[model samples]
Target: MTFRSFIARTRVLLGATALVLAGLPTAASADVVFQSVANPTDVTKFTSPWCSSCSNQYRIFDQFTLGSASSVTGFSVALYSLAPYWGSGLNFSIWTANGNVPGTELFSQSLGNADFTTTTLTGTALMATTDKVSGLNLDAGTYYVSFYNTNLAVWGYTGGGGNLLQQGNTYHTGTSADFILTNNVPEPASIALVGLALVGLGVARRRKA
Candidate 1:
């Protein structure tokens, strides 16, 4: 029946809401774990003729470093071709860095042409592909991602590309490529609830004044 009593009841309701939120499970969201900045001036070209001697052993590798442990779930790359047709598929791998070179293979998979969602950057000239990976657990260290195109279609990379993450290089060995890695990040519901409770308290204080 009283104005102060009403505010007190509202505060109680807000506190109950916060308690309920705290009991709920935290939600997981995806975010970029590593990123490469595109540079026009440093595009590395991968052509069959130039790498005729390159067998199954040769794959383009771009370097990255993690400051802390991570759980990687997916990756994507920008690709293009000067020729009329895009490549068939790409073999992707993550490797441990041996000094400045790719050392041990950690994970690898093949993504077919159909897996790539075709998007045009400049009238079918540039495109990108996205694929989910089984969450790969990695410790804080240097690493490399390698790409092997099944066909002559170029894997876009700039030797001069900027390291947006500030932990790695843009390209390696001219034919090596660059890509973005993604990981699941846990977001606590309790944090949001606490924020809401603080806002409600601020409003109540203003009203009382």
Candidate 2:
């Protein structure tokens, strides 16, 4: 081949290699969905984008009946920050609420906080405190979980108030983050329920005989 043609072919091969390498890192960072293995009532997980001004993620747990009369013995909540930027360098704070909004009561019991500076998308931070609702004694009803950008100074970089990061929106400023929620499984109760059903079936067959 001529000198020019050889140089052109070499450039095309180099460009293809560069594109493949560029895509590998993003493939590694894609978010993972956490699946529940036990009772759906016993465990729940939710995820949403971490916006500066808006509540990106919200969950209403009608299954959980909490009050002075009923108590959740094995209740647990785990929060995971999935922002690629936070894992890289950007800093932000996340907050949670058991109710909806200014009128709703926020979770002040301090489950815990996670910094994703070094962890990958698979990395997670946990707050495994037991009887999380005992102290708060939240009323029996639905609850809401929200995340906000606590650093006003940093959020200001997005041109100040109301420019919150949205889910699936490409970030033009700094990095955006996501959140994850996880609950513990009620192993004993689930196993017992299954066992009782089987026993009941056996007894009914013997009586019929």
Candidate 3:
């Protein structure tokens, strides 16, 4: 074969290799979005700011049943407190809903004054902490997670306060809090399906040749 033809063939081989490499598995491409389970009739993730009046987070679970035989394995929630108050803390809890009443307590955590800071707060610390309820074995059902300000007297903050008030006395109300629910578990057959598809494509290409 001519030298130019040999070079062309090498280039084609390199391009194919690159395409296969691109499809290789990597941690960065893993799925981390909320997804429904195969057996669950209903699923819901709830979150909000930590405050006494923020009862919407609590009432949503009143209408649904949560926690079935197949408990959520990779469910997670992130809590963020936007206000900057000294000695302020956030109290959060997870509950399974059973016909307008919160049933089992899944998990709970409290961030003391040290866990929150207005000076350098950006909602990173809360997100980085893994959910304490990673692999609970409960039934699948509608669930409600709730947040509250357990230390209302100490961590309470109201807007329109005068300048330079006491710690936890500023007008930094809990309006900037948010939560995200995501499914971390991969479908049992997803990997097998992808592998089979790739293999079939290769076999078909060979038969054509």
Task: Supply candidate 3's per-residue lDDT for 112.
Answer: 56
Ranking by TM-score: 1, 3, 2
lDDT of 3 by residue, 1-209 (tens): 66567557656765665566567543322233322222111112212223343332222111123333543323322333344422355555557655544668876666555543232223421331223334444455665444445323112112211111122222233221223233344443445446656755755565566
**lDDT agreement of model 1 with the native:** 0.59
Stretches of candidate 1 above 4 Å error? Answer: 1-29, 38-57, 82-85, 123-125, 152-176, 184-209
- Quote the positional error of residue 191 for candidate 3 in Å: 7.4
Per-model TM-score, in order, reads 0.55, 0.26, 0.34
Tell me the tens digit of each residue's lDDT in model 2 across 26-60: 21122212211222211122233233322423221
Task: Please report the candidate that would top TM-score against the real structure.
Answer: 1
Model 1, position 198: C-alpha lDDT score? 83
For model 3 the local lDDT of residue 57 reads: 25
- What stretches of model 3 exceed 4 Å from their correct place? 1-22, 28-93, 108-133, 148-180, 186-209
Shift of residue 161 alpha carbon in model 3, Å:
34
lDDT of 3 at 15: 65
lDDT against true structure, model 3: 0.37
Prediction RMSDs, each to the true structure: 9.9, 23.1, 13.2
Best by lDDT: 1
Stretches of candidate 2 above 4 Å error? Answer: 1-48, 52-69, 72-102, 111-134, 147-209
